[model samples]
Target: MPSFINNIVTLALASLVLVSNVAGDKLIFRNRSDQVRWIDFTPNTDGTNGIGDVRVEPRQDVEFSMDGYGPEWDRGRGWRGNFRAHRDGAPREYDHIVWGEVCFHCDSQHPEFNTFDVSVVRDPNTQEGIHWMYPRGDPGAGLSGCDHFPCSTCYVNSGDNWQTKTTTSNDIYVEIRNS
Candidate 1:
């Protein structure tokens, strides 16, 4: 390539590194629910999220640093794929005892947290039920919403015929259901 082109490429590459180092990994947690929800991201190693808690106003998309819970944590490690969310609406009625307890708590694990916006999508439904307690990024099986390993635990992670991960990261989204 030409010298000018080479220099431009070099600049772009350098900028990406700078941003990754300075900004670190982040996730766009969009709240599509009708009520506001308070989010508490617990780092796998037990660090509090920014401000010790995050509140995503109704119908708002917020950016969070999964870069560990506190200063002592792994700053580069993005969201823990876990949350303690509280909404203002009445909790939905369900049949199973586990769903009642699980959704009521709004806590779980999955590696889907590490995905980039390009390949992940959070729909109105279908996400992992925060299955299997562990660092989601690690190699292992996960428990889905139905007590199955690696399945749709929440509506967000569920992909339908209408969409795919490459098209939108909407399924990778989260919501604050009424408590």
Candidate 2:
């Protein structure tokens, strides 16, 4: 190969490595509902992501970094949390809407693994449901039948111990819409 072509290839490979090293993994939330929605993240005592409610306008997208949760050692160790979505003007209570519970990087055997589940356990007997899809990354766990009320895809009671885990380290892109 030509010297110039060799140099160019080396630079391109170096650039790709640099970008991948600095680019943090992400959790993207895209709202396809017509109504505005608010996302509330309640992290563990030492976990991050407690920046109050995040508003997402209709047909909009919001991205969140999956990093910065818990301390340096705990980053890959374990961090549990819950995040819920509510319509505009809804009271800031978990019982008023559907929610999701997550255990980010909580696998002791493999810290890269994460467990999560959607639930209506705290709901006030309302007919609220949410639909989520991983368009970019796969968690490699759980079933998806969240098409209607009382969805079989979610936990209906606190006793529901069912959960799913992400087996990959790629950026996760989830689209949540009203159902």
Candidate 3:
């Protein structure tokens, strides 16, 4: 009886550990920035469909310093990244939960929208290449309009163009979590 009880307890503990680890891998994004920033996310591929790589484009703008610092000196800047799918394979459709925003800032000083646009696509025949877009605005909003096909395009008016001109090292955490 004693041995049987011990086995059950051990099994319970092991199950708990496994559950925690799986939960931990559920995708997390952290904001390591010192100032509040704005961000946007767009899906680049149907990694959710077990397709190719999952790519995300992150566009950010750190509000100009409240104090008389010129916009050129503002520490806030832009970023573009591609996050590969988790080891469990592509995320499920319902698991698609994208969330991001100004992690920290000196207050809502800048009113202009600091957003990120993204596009995801995969080639059925050729897995050798991937296509993407930046500053893809809301489709229904008709802000930037939607591209009929996937391409390597960037939105100049959407604030993603800042990366082409300069680099801002500001820490902005953007993440997609599966619930």
Highest TM-score, which number? Answer: 2
Q: Between the candidate structures 1 and 2, which one is better when assessed by lDDT?
A: 2
Q: Candidate 2 at residue 15, lDDT?
A: 73
Q: What C-alpha lDDT does candidate 3 achieve relative to the native structure?
A: 0.27
**Clash list (residue pairs), candidate 2:** none
Task: Judge candidate 1 at residue 116 and give its lDDT.
Answer: 20
Better of 1 and 2 by TM-score: 2
Query: Against the true structure, whose lDDT is highest?
Result: 2
Point out the worst 10-residue segment of candidate 1 by lDDT. Answer: 97-106
Compute the lDDT of residue 114 as modeled in candidate 1: 33
lDDT of 3 by residue, 5-73 (tens): 999999999777433322211112322223222222233223211213333322222222112111232
Candidate 1 global CA lDDT score: 0.36
What stretches of model 3 exceed 4 Å from their correct place? 26-179
> Could you tally the backbone clashes for each prediction?
31, 0, 12
Give the runs in model 1 whose Cα sits over 4 Å from its true position: 1-22, 46-51, 67-81, 89-179
**What C-alpha lDDT, on a 0 to 100 scale, does residue 11 get in candidate 2?**
100
In angstroms, how far off is 89's CA in candidate 2?
Answer: 2.1
